[model samples]
Target: MEALFLPQIQQRNGCSPVQPAFPTKVYNGHSQETIHLHPFMIGPVTDTKVSLTISNGPKTLQLEVDLHDTVDQLKKRIMQERKFGGSESISLLYENRELKSSETLGQQNVKNQATLFIVHKCNGG
Candidate 1:
């Protein structure tokens, strides 16, 4: 009987080690069958930008943004454009629900030409 030694697999970046689908046949310190490993590929990002209308009181601001942008990113853009002071906190609302800072616009279903209400708050006295 011949002894087969498998290579040590290590986990990276908190991800689990990849497990083989089935047992591999090893012969004379070499794999008898060819093991094809394909690199993980991510799909290309689209350049499509959605137009969003932000309503704050009687004033409305038009913004064109990518769907992948998070709510915090959008708020930063608004702050830049409006020259909002650091003391002001901005909140975005869609359909009466507050948008989460960590969530993307696409995840929240904020489509093109969508109207988002902006609520402003002063941080301190």
Candidate 2:
């Protein structure tokens, strides 16, 4: 009998596993059969966290966030941590470029342990 093994399918960032459309096939002489593997054999997806260091001049802060978290959410976290007033405008910069509030960390290609800069602007004098 001959057994064929297929390569494991994984999604980007190794966050999840993709199942194949067909099951393992075993061939013996003039006969063929299929075997279904248990779902536990495929393993489970682990929760991956992205850590970022945000710097505002001499002060710095560390944040743990998900890849799907948007820049706006991150800004809110920063505001809460820093206790900034509502009139304060917060800007996040990664690699010297300003990050959009609607964009996610994954969309921005922000890797773990990446350093970001914070710029604060107060509306009205």
Candidate 3:
């Protein structure tokens, strides 16, 4: 009824859906005016550590890692478990995205109990 159309009306009025109440700074509106912004540090996010499952065909491996660990670090850990001689031959896939080596677990948006696909990248013959 009215509830259904209310959201549309809010959107038309430019109301943001995902807005957090953060403090705003004042603007002097001058090129010469130097504005320094202090880094706003929020509280630590819960569950800094996460357990990820890597699915490789019939076999699956699970490992616990810190959110700050880079993808290359995860690759090394997997290398220890599997006989993949080199990590270069293998690739990690998450939701159709090929994970980069330098990206951290948090940067890649990896969550707790998340499953990643371990696949072999076919090279040009």
Candidate 4:
């Protein structure tokens, strides 16, 4: 079976996951300046408590979940708690990263005390 992996970091769009998507800058030895991406990211998905603030439109939901759970599971829980019928239309965005359904919370680099934006996917022609 394929391992469920989520993007780790603060993407232009925000979402949830095990990795913490904080941005980092590296300085080159030469006078020339350059920006670089980190090879890996991390999150606080351990025994420690992780709090997430989910915002959907005018409504805001605060959820606490285990790091071991999958992102899809988190979506289900959110839909159940919010009484949202259209789970298919929902997507979790945090720090510019869109959380994939097949990935786990740890894969997405979701960190403690991060704010997630619950938005609907746009339809295209």
Best by lDDT: 1
Q: How close is every model to the real structure, measured as TM-score?
A: 0.57, 0.64, 0.59, 0.55
**lDDT value for model 3:** 0.73
lDDT of 3 at 71: 93
Ten-residue segment with the worst summed lDDT in candidate 1? 32-41
Displacement of the residue 120 alpha carbon in candidate 4, Å: 1.3
Predicted candidate 1 versus true structure: per-residue lDDT over 32-74, tens digit per residue = 5434422343698565589999887777888899999999999
What ranking of all candidate models by lDDT puts the best one first? 1, 2, 3, 4
lDDT accuracy of residue 5 in candidate 3 = 14
Q: Which stretches of candidate 4 lie over 4 Å from their true place?
A: 1-48, 83-88, 122-125
Model 3 regions more than 4 Å off: 1-44, 83-88
- Best-fitting candidate, scored by TM-score: 2
RMSD of each: 9.2, 8.4, 15.1, 17.9
Candidate 3 TM-score versus the reference? 0.59
What would the per-residue lDDT of candidate 3 be over residues 24-85, giving only the tens digit for each residue?
Answer: 34343444332342335589858779999998887788899999999989988998886444
lDDT (10s digit) by residue, model 2, range 30-120: 6443333433455777565889998888788899999899999999898889644453788999998999899998899888999989888
Superpose all Cα atoms of candidate 1 onto the true structure and report the RMSD in Å to 1 decimal.
9.2
> After aligning candidate 3 to the native by TM-score, how far in Å is the CA of 5 from where it should be?
51
Q: How accurate locally is residue 36 in candidate 2, as Cα lDDT from 0 to 100?
A: 34
